[model samples]
Target: MYSSIYGGIIRHKFPLYKPNVNLEQLFGKHILFLFSFLTHENLNRAIRGGALESTRDVTIANREHLSDYLKVRDEYLYELDVHLDRFLSSASKAKISSPFSRSALRSILIQLTAASKCKKGTLRYWPSAGPGDFLLSSTGCPTSAFYAVVIDQELSQCKEGVKVITSSIPMKPPLFATAKNVNYLPNVLSVMEAEEKGASSSIWVDEEGYIAEGPNVNVAFITQDKELVMPPFDNILHGCTAKRLLELASKLVDQGLLKGVATKKLTVEEAKAAAEMMYVGSTLPLLPIIVWDDQPIGNGRVGELTMLLSDLLWDDMVAGPDTQRIPVPYAE
Candidate 1:
């Protein structure tokens, strides 16, 4: 498994410590702590009751295991209400309103759960201002968004071999790209567009005409000279999965397993001429683009770099955090 560093320190380098044997007791304590934290009044009461003073001494003993402590802290943060209506109203006024349907939210959450190796579930949809903004602003929630839409045939042919899945209706960008709050729309639309074009999915273009990413995934390409390249973050959503792949790419470059991948504002012509192209995201980890806008990408087939990156990404997913343990089921 690939290693990660936070704050310049390798995560794995930290010594591991097993949790207390009495899991129930530990969990109870966690709940109590969370309750106190969530209710400031209660915390003040606890402080007066000597609870805070006693805990301060105990906290020092667990400082080394701060990561685990932070995990528990995050759980409490998630428990806080998101005040969705307030956010929605604010987003609407800002012209960043979303057209997310309940079905779309359910489908996306299910897909993410599966992709992230979590349980089957649905997530709450919140309106976002644009691609750069996090879909879910609440702390400890899925930061990404989902879109499901239909792409024009012309755009679908940009990538060869990838099929698009079209809906009976011309799926609007709200279900796919252009919406700030929902993220899954792009993935669904990319797939729809690809199936519609007799390909697998649609290839996305940034404002500069360079390949930004696929609907729900990020794009990576190897130039004719075998230089690996990924799109800069300016034009696309900062995909968590994509971030991880980039991290892996850095490692691969160090080992000479692959050329150093660079992010830049690439033009459409530059992307189309690349020797290889692939899509990366939560669900479709790495899908090679054999064609672009009816033109053959590379040799009109999946390239070797695409496969290598896909394999590397899969390994990381298996070793990553367990997203399912949080259990964000559909709201009743």
Candidate 2:
């Protein structure tokens, strides 16, 4: 973990992550599940305290922070510039000031990845409003702070298909939805709804009945006409991976594998009728959706074109052009 408040990367004597046998046992027995009620006369005053130290951040009280989490593969940061650009744009939208310059932050992330020796995982960073008084306005906050962390994990292309449901939770309004902010309560509820119904995740349909996106990933569809279509970015987060997939899909069009590529508004009726469906995002890159709302999506199996597109993305992530992947300066 790297914290601007700490002035650099925080060293750990042990591995950054480890499976805890105790936590496993506790969760297995559902011991942490709570069902209790307590009455306190000072309950109203309980919300009047705030922390002024960076160690205890105001992130819980303030919902205006911005972030970017990107994949690190083979000691390289994938799509570094694209993700940084989006991160900065999001910061501008949220009015959060970055403690470091963009170039400095990029350098710090690369250094952090190299230091962690994490070859296959994610690098997530954030620029928060910093510690401040508990108030709706951020006027009490001092300078903003930045933090980044690297996780070590296994990475592989997603081949199997998953099911999805139409989210009953209301999607965020266009103002908040367009920018990547930390306010994700509705997204969390939408996914929980899907899980309760035995689905992998859920998709958001706008107030107008147009296909919006998945909980955290962008949705793409392949029409029976062999066209690759994605919902426009007007009311959704402009996904860096999704945009790159669009650029790469052009190759399919050129080779006659796909009829065309487009970004347009898609209705639920039009979307559910598609020959293939997939979710596009940073990690999964591409996840095939074989079923939606219990109905078989085009024969109830992973679409061939969907995997082909996944291969395109996977190959690019592993061995794409130099512009898309940056080699980390790991110490020899």
Write down the RMSD of all candidates, one decimal each. Answer: 18.2, 9.6
Q: Per-residue lDDT for 1-332 in model 2, tens only? A: 67675567744232222334243243233222111112122342111111112433556566557767889998889999999998888888888888889899999989888877667888887788876776766787886777777766567889899999999999998877877777889999999999999999999999999999988789999999999999999989999999999999999999999999999999999999999999999989899999999988888899999999999999998899999999998878
What does candidate 1's lDDT look like per residue over 1-332, in tens digits?
A: 00010011111111222333342353334221111111112232111110111122112222110000001111111111222232333355334434454454334433332222212211222232222212233232222222211111111112224632222223223222322333344456557666766776666664445556665557778888777788876545555556667777876678776767778778778877888877765445567777766777788777766777777765543343453123334223
Top candidate by lDDT: 2
C-alpha lDDT (0 to 100) for residue 209 of candidate 2? 91
- In model 2, the runs with Cα more than 4 Å from the true position are 14-55
Per-model TM against the reference: 0.46, 0.87
Give model 1's TM-score versus the native structure: 0.46
Question: Any idea what lDDT model 1 has?
Answer: 0.43
Among these predictions, the greatest TM-score belongs to: 2
